[model samples]
Target: MDHYSFFDRDLSWLLFNERILMEAEKETLPVLERVNFLSIFSSNLDEFYRVRIPVLLAVHKLAKRGSSEKEDVLLEAQALIGYQQQKFGKIFTGQLIPLLKQHKVNLLFNEPIPNNIADKVMDYFYSQVMSFLQPIDLADTKKSFFPENNRLYFFISLRTANDLERNVILAIPSNQLPRFYSVSVADEQYILFLDDIIRHNLNKLFKNEVVTGCYSFKITRDAELDLKDEYHGDLSEQIEKQLLKRDMGIATRFLHQPGIPLRTLHFITDKFGLQSSSVVEGGIYHNLKDLMSLPVNNPLLRYTRWAPINSYHVTDEGSLFDHIEKQDYIFHAPYQSYNTILRFFNEAATDASVDEISVTLYRVASDSRIVNALISAANNGKKVRVMVELKARFDEANNIKWAKKMKAAGVDIIYSDKALKVHAKIALVKRQVNGRDKYSGLLATGNFNESTAAFYTDHIMMTANPLLLREMELLFMFLAKGKKSAEGYPVDFKHLLVAQFNLQSRFMELIDQEIANAKQGLPAAITIKLNNLEERKLIGKLYEASQAGVKINMIVRSICCLIPGVKGMSEHINIRRIVDRYLEHGRIFVFENNGDQKVFMGSADWMNRNIYRRIEVCFPVYDEKIKAEVMQLISLQLQDNVQAVNLDTALQNIRIEPKPPLIQAQRGIYEFLKAKSDN
Candidate 1:
């Protein structure tokens, strides 16, 4: 193994979070959009602490006392995130709210509200929100109050008629009520958080007690769901049991008032065995992410909706299968319509010839039309086999619900077997054409979510090649049966690089070939576009290639740990991150194999989990025209200066200094596709 010094993964992830914060800090972005950026930053951090940080903590505790690197990494991550969290608070409270006020939108609290508005709020709370309040007196009760994930609570302190301090805990019923309620007075419209609604009604909630003050806060727990070895019982049932305990996860971070009387804090912490260090003194309000749901009775506060552009390859007159039969068609999602992939399934369902449909669903939308079409296929007497992964992060419940729905629809459902989670996005359809068995399949980089398809850039390869589609069917067969002893067909994968089989080796070989070409004074280059790049071995290989004079250009949207542009180390490597209107999610790899370029796009990223652990597929672009189009898209992204930010050696995100006449890549690509359609 090559001696490598890589940035810690957790710290690198924190840097990604900071980059998101940087977007919030940008004055160029719209004021409301900036607030949305802060909301995104907080939500992303909540998930990071819930899933990733807890795993690291578990690994550290299991290892006992070997390397200090893990602990060090955790400490550094906490410090960096803490700094960024402070910055986020400052930006939101100091900058964004003031800007919103300038736009005539004021988010007010209980700081001497104007008498008329205060009376109106009190009347509103009494008639509309008072009945929803449930208060527990903490002074006399031995029963504890445990808040669920992302739930808001208020600690109310009161002075009784006997001149004694008493406390009551109230749960904010925002789940049942809107987070923001608009109240209009004379000529001004004011927005108030539901927290304030409860705040305004404190005296009503504690009718007998005289309310002194009430503070609003929340706690985010470590959300890593643990599971045991599978037994003879049903797996779905077992998962359901485990999921019920999801709320009981260890508390990771607690956001509370700055000084709520140390005794009161201690009482609450003692009940939960939480330490003060884990407790963050957040502002008066908790769960600021509720800002994302800002009721837009005013359409001017929201972003203008943009329709997803349709791909040039898809036309109203033809079956998607017929088009794929001619040549491999690549669907670039959000940019190119996801309807192409949907039409593929819809057509397969309606076609009398299609005999079987197999798909692997990871994170699907709640109202998934994809699942609806799959059900329609099963109803049409087609063999619909769905390998629904219930282990998708934060989406386990949704996946489980869909799994039961699909199972009830008479579709064959397969859950994951062992330690592996099937993260692949593949759909195989077996059809009979001219009384002969023909196959079609789709391999995508992102999940089959229709709503997200309008905002997330993804690539899906639709093909009718028997050589590839037959293997996909077999692969799903093996996945469904859980037959580990069964070997895959001994056929050469000329186009697709399936993980757990050939993806890693193929990537290494491609990198080595580039290195060799560079040494031989030939044209050698590589371009990689991925959501994350954190695998140490792959980064080392890229560094080796870079040292050998191979130019590498990388567009990694998140969690990039490699240090680029270092003298004598990775001088030839260029790293850029694009945060634009659409999420840059498609994973594409282009290698200059002695100038005979090879381009591939699929679900796999450079993360080790994607390559060596999970089931992923990266398929080569066979059609020259499509390959050219993909190359043009990649080239446009490579040259993007408007939304692109360069990553420095220390991972500090430096804004890309744009040229005079700048190009925003997504808009440019839309124009490019439109021009192609016109031609």
Candidate 2:
């Protein structure tokens, strides 16, 4: 409870994953959706180890300045992950299994196939699965062979012709084949894991050698790309070179099935040269993250679908730009269709009055309609410029491909700055309104990727404001010139809060104003909705605001370091984390300016990278109706009892105090918007 102390970001992230696990543990939800949550949890941990574990290990090997703090954090993260995996096991076996049986979708794990479907499964093994699998003998191979990262493998204990025990590894081709095999036998239906199918047919895999036992295991390698801090060459080329060597990075986690003979374990470790800490004991079947493709088409066993509804702007006739000029509109995504945002680009591409289009692409969908529109606009002879960030971790290749395509289409492709990443989501379309050039653009709290926009909560503002649009034009010019020309780039802005220059200072000033108001006995409050909050200065400022009696509420989806509700230190602050059907991704900052409230939404979180290393934007909600809409949305999220967990002093995601009426914020937003559209 000491003042100025913060939670470790990695550990806080584990608590967030734990919240996702809790969703899988819920008995009320349909078994399929619960399975989806389980898949999400497992996948989240997989990426965590892939991306973060190497960074910690690098402090010793790469940085050569290894600290005990990093070591301690790795240990803590691993221990928590181990504990959660145990819980996951129990949920899958104890809860999920029985529920599956109740629904007649028997998802068999490592257990043997039933007598009725045994023949059918054997037929599938020979016809489909057997052709793809080829086991490699670990003891017989001369050199150490590396397995593909995160792939499911069967570690077999075989008795050779000499009556000696030999261990071999056979990969489960879940990548090429489906993980779950559905077998329909007469009146009942069954789902079997590919692990079990391989396990039952081990004799067929090794015809000459006698198979004794089969167990599942997987390995996770360090997936961090260590691009040189100072790269004078092409960023895309360096990243591509590193990406090819990703599988060869340090082995972070070596997870094997529990109770594998010590001799086999030792042979496996010695072959791979794995450290003691790298080895982790897992359950029967590895890589349950494949549960996402359960392949069941039953609607009754899934959450009732709530389709995204179109708002008034999309349905309104005439140009999309004209509507924005008349009034600033916000697209509350998934609750409202992302099609409107897509329509903006489509209309801009075809509009004869529009002559120039510019935007920043951080992470776009694989099949992006927005990109298609930009291509169309460029082909139509309009000046289209795109500043594409090629450093969007795991998405570098896709962005590069799009960049090449856009460049070939006569569009100006802008690479990122050498030292900084462009993370802002903004698009500008300049059109001649009565021979006077005006701008219609969008400022969003998330990526322009329509695929993620379906579920990731974000605020996209469509406006034709002269001041904001002019600044956006200047920003595109600044980005187009690359890093060296940023001197006279007009970094100082009065309307849009730009990161690396004004965002942090402006936020601190706002917090200071709240503190002053609180000291003057005026109504002072601040509400923040973001994905992460790990910035030290901002967290310290929040501590100051809490001491000054400004009430604060936060809805952080992941990685919250600031502990709340502590006596005398953070008594006036409370934080809520909501994990529901849709991701809580919008970053809304609401400050009570006495009786008048000011709202801002943006891409930047209160994190170090977002505040300093990247270019971000936070725009104000000026329209009264839009402001009220955001206020109500945040209020609904704050009031959510279901799917909302209170981040306790010990960093535990404890259940909120339940009341009679329940409020799930994602559902609330959808219903609120749908009701408005109906009216």
Candidate 3:
């Protein structure tokens, strides 16, 4: 058991998805809420096939440079996903469907529609949905219809009146129509997928032909759009062109009904050039993730919504930066109001004394107040520089749109170089107070998108620390001026760990200190909560510390490759994942550091892209109270028996080494924090 070796990355990611499925299976959750989790699982797996599995398969086929482990990684990933998909199916149709019925919310398939409801459904379809419905005959035209990315399609099997057997694929007009068609029938409100509405009306679609049963199916194509540098004249133009061609990216998974006739399957597969036997056989309907949009007005059917609570400063006192100058304030979002951060931007935009504002946009919301603030600042004669990453996955188009808008408003917009993405969430504001130039900055663990700010548990730190502020100014200079020399920026950061120089080394130094302390038989330990932990070097360092008897606890929300609890190998390492109310985002790294307990929180995870390839900032928790708060969160997550899954030596996702009474950590933490504020 070499310290450098660990579990395969893809297999570990599958284990993380299994943890999400486990949350959906928790009986304590309300029925419809469980349904939401199932939809999320289905959606997540669809992405896994489209993005991840294809990459692994491609590497295995090409045996790209130095990927000797590619074939084995792919095989292990296939096995793990196959097993998890089986479990996902059981949870969805077996548990979720029956449970929905228990709440009088029935998701029916081919169940005879009552006359009154069928009439209403027909009327609704004719008025609203019929205009958009365009059913293509697959038999007449051997021409294949490619389903749009993540869109639903129905395969219609028909026997002609002349005894000519044929199969036709109908594109369910779900993109134009509402996914859920609600009808009031027999005093029950039934929600039907739009696919069902088309299924009920097959006769109307195939005017002259006799109709047979319609089986619902969908195909998830490789969504990764490759903008080849040699082929693409312009990066933005190539990306835009590929966005249209993304539907045609090599087909990864042909998800279909289990009972599709052999002939139909062969014809479809051959037409689509699908040579693999990895066709996923699902139940009648595919893409039930659309059920997430189902209209169920019952408040009890969803998780109890909590409006973002205010921090001690904003709720008790009005001014944000005023308190920031006195002491650095840490804000945890989705729990703490993100509006406060918005207020910071809003104030900066309107302040007459503020001279400049700079921010990096990785992913901005469609209607972003942050963008609007930048525009307002530029309009007010302030130097507003925005570095928007145009290569953000699936978000390139939105970012391009906003970049143009911001540029039109006089913002000095800087798009990233094609090779690297600027993922750092940073905002620097320069103001003049009493004829002295003062600097304030906001460092965030998530995007500037307000939409996700409600569902993603992230942290934003507001500080007036001249040391950090000056270093941030240097970072912006590096982005704008492209200075290679260390002296071009304020390089001395005693508090912050900025990538490109000290982040990786500082992390190793912290881990080595823990290992040395453990070797000395001191109280040495480390705890990390991050979104991803796939970088081999970081994992190896942790393993080294673990082997040296340093206790390690990690609560990684996704893509963990390290195998924990292996005897004499990783015996002191433990890993758990929490999938609950809000997304377990926000990267927090804690080091025992010879029992002084150094803690840092930031936007960057331990992934290769985050640590080296992007400009990220991991800031220290100078405020002891906030450090304790974050530490408490890691402690609760590690202790969580419910809504948390533990990874074993074999990389099996076992639900937290079960104890008598389980602690559902996320809920417990919420209660714990809310109670603290109340006290």
Best by TM-score: 2
Tens digits of lDDT, candidate 2, 426-523: 99999987989888999999999999988888889999888888888777877887864344555668888888668898999999999999999999
Total clashing pairs in model 2 = 0
Per-residue lDDT of model 3, residues 1-679, tens digit only? 2436666667777777777777778898887778788788778888888888787767776665665654547776777777877787788778887777777777765576667677888888778777876666765565557666666777777777787767776777777778887765555678777777877887876777777656666777788777674663656677788888888777777888778778878877886677753577776677767767878888888878876665555553645566678887777778777777888889889988789999999989999998999899889999999989888988989988888889999998876666567888889998888999988889888988899998898888888988888878877887896443333465666667877768888899999999899999898999998899888888888888988999998888888878788777688888877788889888999998876899988888888888767777888877788788888877877778777877777766677566867777767776766777677
Ranking the candidates on lDDT from highest down gives 2, 1, 3
Q: Which ten residues in a row have the lowest lDDT in candidate 1?
A: 483-492
Task: Encode model 1's per-residue lDDT on 216-316: one tens digit a residue.
Answer: 76777776666676466777777787788887778777778676778878877786666632576777777777778775455555556556666677678
TM-score of each: 0.95, 0.96, 0.93
Model 1: per-residue Cα lDDT at residue 397 = 87
* Candidate lDDT values, in order: 0.80, 0.86, 0.79
Question: Sorted on TM-score, highest at the top, how do the candidates line up?
Answer: 2, 1, 3
